[model samples]
Target: MPHTPGSYTTSDLSRKSGDIIAEALRHPVTITQRNKPRLVLLNIEDYDRLMRQSDARSAMTLETMPDELFGEFETAVGAYADSDEAGR
Candidate 1:
């Protein structure tokens, strides 16, 4: 496979952990094994940001959602239902 930026093999990770972690602090790094991608190393800020984004996408009660987001959700659901009915 073609070499990807920020990608390191498992052996490279074991041998060059400090260097790899430094690089990960600047951006995400992929850890590969057997030429397949296995894991990602990222800074805590990036990880937390990803988790927050995931939380935003997860199921929530209408009462818990902000008014703007609820409006957008309502609009999206209506558009999706309209499209689905058109397809049928």
Candidate 2:
């Protein structure tokens, strides 16, 4: 089940903070204040995994690119097509 931060008040955590940290170690703890989620405490492994996935997604978005260094891609494609037709 997803951890519910609202289930425990700040006082509950402050009084038994070690238990809270231990629980967070097992899974992320969604910490809330004033009934809104304010923080997520995750173990190191999970945080690292999330960061790696974000980096991979950013890399994938940069892979496909136009050939021209200074002009629109349509101009590049049209130039290529015109050259091919002339050669034929």
The TM-score leader among the candidates is 1
Indicate the residue-level lDDT of 79 in model 1.
100
The residue pairs found clashing in candidate 2 are none
**Model 2 residue 41 lDDT score:** 74
Error of 2 at 81 (Å): 7.5
lDDT of 1 by residue, 13-87 (tens): 899899999999999999999999999999999999998878555677999998999999899999999999999
Angstrom error at residue 48, model 2 = 0.6
Poorest stretch of ten by lDDT in candidate 1: 51-60
Give, for candidate 2, the lowest lDDT window spanning 10 residues: 55-64
Candidate 1 similarity to native, TM-score = 0.60
lDDT of each: 0.93, 0.68
